[model samples]
Target: MDTTVNGEPRVLATDAAVALIDEIRRDYPDILFHQSGGCCDGSSPMCYPTDDFIVGDHDVKLGEISGVPVYISASQFEAWKHTQLIIDVVAGRGGMFSLDNGREKRFLTRSRMFGGGEACAIPGVQKVV
Candidate 1:
């Protein structure tokens, strides 16, 4: 699946991330991908089951990046509503999809803006293998 980012087209379905998402979907059809407010350094990416996984304000195709529907926080969904976003599936030692753009800034795991670190933790989301 390709989406525009920074006015350029980017592929969101990476081989590794897509495979992982497919496996997880077998158990949990509804999942969410978000970054924890802050962690050791800054914000960290999070993937897990969500009890309140609303579409927010984003109108992204749920099946584009596999059957697992993608949803963002209401605030985040609104923030990037105007900007084109590509959900690139990724996997590595660190985490999942990495938000790449000219602006390079680490996302804190326990960001105060994201409702602190305590609220960032997911119930069943495991690290991508």
Candidate 2:
């Protein structure tokens, strides 16, 4: 799958992550990701069945990985707007309430800062203030 939407990608997934996502999709066809900001989950990416969690109006959609939409709270987006989120799978427990819970591995969020002259090109992401 293409890692980018237009010219740049705001989010991406590793091969392992894509495999895990495909495994999860077998059980839950419609799933999405929400990047938690240092709450109970300690900044891990939370996965859920699309209808299970509500996407708040202030949340920003950061494009898709493995065909699943990824989002972050508007507040968190401001803090991470300059980085590209790389979704990876690691050996550990997932968030207590996340769909990946109970699975042997969990989804992890890794990131890299955008280079000079490279701006966030994803649609719907606007500069806040």
Candidate 3:
């Protein structure tokens, strides 16, 4: 295993995205993000109140960005396992059920394929699935 502090699994949020999340935090101090793979949002990162949303057994924790925990469904994780998720902010409304809605800007997901060894070395990822 890679023992470097940087080896820890990380989810990145752009400055603009972090700023928006901070603004939303004023009202929802404990918010979480789930990158849905289904339709409607089409892989957009969705943010919700931690108390209001439930992280399912099949979900995987992808570390947090700006104090907000980020999760992805098992099925989605399978497809995204080789990629690093980068959260970004874009103009427009967010998901209807997400906290970013009505904020005039929404969170988006960008990614980069991980280098072979780095992918396996990313801490906090379950090697089994």
Candidate 4:
């Protein structure tokens, strides 16, 4: 429920996303998501068992999406800080390493920029290396 401008927990989920996350939890209760900066997954939000991916100082915790911790690269955070990320589920295969893969559905991240009063107070995000 926390939405600090730059703080962790900036990412949120839609009903569909939450449902999908719950479904994934059945098999992998400790899963998490990291927005791919590029390369292997082409910026898709990749899901994995939390213990699988290593969070480093360069990664910033954006927030929790559907109870799953969501993180983005520090550089991406600098570019996307003004926007709010909304996680959703769409029909398709996700990144091969993502837990959602092979499920006929993939997790998606949609974003919108803050407006008006909110534009000036984009909160700071936190990082857990």
Candidate 5:
């Protein structure tokens, strides 16, 4: 599937991320990420938003991970462009690429605790549904 963030296109995952995007696109009418400052693991997982969010410079705009619309920041997007974003199914499913000091960086999420949505674990590598 084609992944685009902030109107830019990039291949984030081999298939897992793409598949998820595809599934969400079909049934989910509203798609976006809940971005914040930090998390226990230095950053939080991207989640389906309950409201509208603005694309910011610090946010990574993920075109489509697993066919789901993901919005990240420009900084995060630039960081993961040339690196392989590893999608670990066990630690939850979706993905976002990041470059930490010129090296490929990856963020994976299964359950997000924001936006009035319950923290639900998602499929390991399946497309969003």
Candidate 6:
């Protein structure tokens, strides 16, 4: 289902992802997600304890899922701002450093471009100059 930040829809998470988040929460009460823009993890969504990772100044808070804040880098956001991010759980290993690594299920990011009306409804979207 769609998750919003301050009532503005931004991201979505599958039921399996929500269940995994719930399970992860049992250990790390304060957790968050960051959409990796390739490199070691190859664009997977990484989950971490809130205290473990430092959110950069340029990071954008997309939304929250299961009460956990989700973020993406400003550069990544610029490239993906026109789309809605959907977080899904798939059978595999998570990012090496992510909390979900040992669970054998990784968080994947899937997205779809926002429709005209939907684009207008999202906050922070700007017209190309």
Candidate 4 lowest-lDDT run of ten: 120-129
Q: Go through the candidates in order and give the C-alpha RMSD of each one to the true structure.
A: 13.3, 7.0, 6.4, 6.1, 13.2, 7.2
Displacement of the residue 50 alpha carbon in candidate 1, Å: 4.9
Report the lDDT of model 6 for residue 27: 93
Stretches of model 6 off by over 4 angstroms after superposition? 1-8, 116-129
TM-score of each: 0.39, 0.85, 0.82, 0.82, 0.40, 0.83
- Estimate candidate 1's alpha-carbon lDDT, on a 0 to 1 scale: 0.39
Q: In model 5, which regions exceed 4 Å deviation?
A: 1-29, 34-41, 50-52, 57-60, 86-88, 91-129
Q: Which digits, one per residue and each the tens of the lDDT, describe model 3 over residues 25-122?
A: 99988899999997987778999999999999999888778777789998888787867777888899999899999999998887766664354332
Which lDDT tens digits does candidate 2 get at residues 1-129?
333434568887777788888999999999999999996999999999999999999999998887899999999988988778888888989999988899989999887687764654433332221
Q: How high a TM-score does candidate 4 get?
A: 0.82
Residue 117 CA displacement from its true place in model 6, Å: 5.8
Clashing pairs in 3: none
Model 5 global lDDT (CA atoms, 0 to 1)? 0.41
**Worst window of 10 by summed lDDT in candidate 2:** 120-129
- Positional deviation of residue 124's Cα in model 3 after best superposition, in angstroms: 25
Clashes of 2: 0
Better of 1 and 4 by TM-score: 4
Q: Put down candidate 6 lDDT per residue, 1-129, tens digits, no spaces.
A: 234433446787777888899999999999999999989999989999999999999998887776788899999988988777878788988899999999999888777676654544323332211
| Deviation from native of the Cα of residue 86 in model 3, angstroms | 0.2
Model 4, 1-36: lDDT tens per residue? 234654433676777778788899999999888888
Higher lDDT: candidate 1 or 3?
Answer: 3
Question: Model 6 lDDT vs. the true structure?
Answer: 0.79
